[model samples]
Target: MSRTPDNWLLKVTGLTKIYGEPNENTLALTGPQFGSNICPETESIVACADINFELYPGEVLGIVGESGSGKSTVVKMLYFDIEKTYGEALLKPYANAGVNTLDESNQKKRYIRNHLMGMVYQNPRDGLNFNFTSGGNIAEKLIMAGNYHVGGIRERASELLVKTEVPVLRMDDRPSNFSGGMQQRVQISKAIANNPPLLFLDEVTTGLDVSVQAKVLDLIRELQHELGIAMIVVSHDLSVIRMLTDRTMVMKNGRIVESGLTDQILQDPQHAYSQLLVSSLL
Candidate 1:
């Protein structure tokens, strides 16, 4: 595994968001701002607010919470899927320069996505191009990152497919022909095609069967360690957090209620909401 020597690969601070017209959105106050008391009928709803975290190279960080806890929103903002109302993130290679992704141009962001990071979504369709063959999907990422040789692209696709436990012979099949689990595996293969240093998994196992979920999670665990990549895993399942992440942050109503080692948070939750969440999982 080739790893950068950076202490913090990713650092986030004061991540916040609000939806709707400006002044109409409940006076636009900054939030510690986990959740809002103002009725949505009043106008603005806070999706996530004042969020902060630091991710070290080769470290796995888990953001776990119930639906609507703002976990997904944070990742969406980071990956540039949606615009953030406000926030800052500094990533390595760019760390010393302290570049916030939100401040980067679209072209630079595109370059970063293709060469520096990877993302796997819960819905395979969001990540996979159903019309493209499995190998083609992976090749797309490589091409965008500037690889041009057909032979090299195909060879790398086969390597990644095998690594992800997908059959190499199935490389030419379109994702539309795959089962949900297989499609997700293909997506994972594509995400890591560039051997990106940072990865994001958002609700990856949400719709898989239990056995399939286990295998997919195992693949993720093995690949992360093998590649020495830093990752942010977003899930509502605490079990997923326990199995994959080194540290866990418990979020509620769009705010992180508690953050600590996974074992510590699960075994000795301090926040009322976190306690309720853990107990409910019992």
Candidate 2:
């Protein structure tokens, strides 16, 4: 179910990120054509450039690339984890989509993050506070979204734990005490605590055991179906993209080489880099 231009949940245009001062030709000299993200003249890194996409409500979009390909940088910028060099991201639920979220004040960005979006990082430690118990983490998210009643917070936390297949009994335990897989499940529980419309998942199952990764992916699929949440999943693994995404963007050297429906990309990858990635799956 694709959305029309009139009803995109999130629209991003000219999304770019750079690590150092770059000259006008930085973007022009870098990317797939050069097989690098570095500018030879300025020695600056163009993390990603001219990224444009629209994610519809309940849609799952995949960004696939190898390490240092800037796939993670794109979402980090959108989620405000890292400041973008330049970009405009508009969310339908915020300011009627008239505002560029990247330019918003920090307080406003926090509000948007708490109420409109959620992010699950590759490392559970990045997303969860080790000092806080599982339930405490969820409570923090709920409180930020304005759910103040203690009883309500507890109940909601328990419910989220159950929804994410984490035992409610572990609610009082800190994530540091949980297994890697369990900690990730708890992270997912906390991420969706507010019922945000959009979620960003960065290599969510990258380090897990094969069986555990499958389980976590299944949990994510279940939650997306149950909550109708739109997601942007970033990963180097094409298999993960195949199982989870409706559409895919194949990226290399800080630029997207091709994009299309997931099935089509897998069956008929067009670009040389994309073909190499797809062949790796076989």
What tens-digit string does per-residue lDDT give for candidate 1 at 216-246?
A: 9999999987898899999999899989998
lDDT of 2 by residue, 3-98 (tens): 776999999999999999999899999999899999999999999999999999999999999998999999999999999999899999999999
Per-prediction TM-score: 0.92, 0.99
Error of 1 at 17 (Å): 1.5
Candidate 1: where are CA atoms >4 Å away? 1-6, 22-41, 95-97
Assess the local accuracy of residue 46 in candidate 1 as a C-alpha lDDT between 0 and 100.
74
lDDT for residue 70 in candidate 2, whole number 0-100: 92
Q: Pick the candidate with the highest TM-score.
A: 2
Each prediction's number of clashing residue pairs:
0, 0
Model 1 misses residue 239 by how many Å?
0.4
**By lDDT, who's the top model here?**
2
Q: Candidate 2, overall lDDT?
A: 0.96
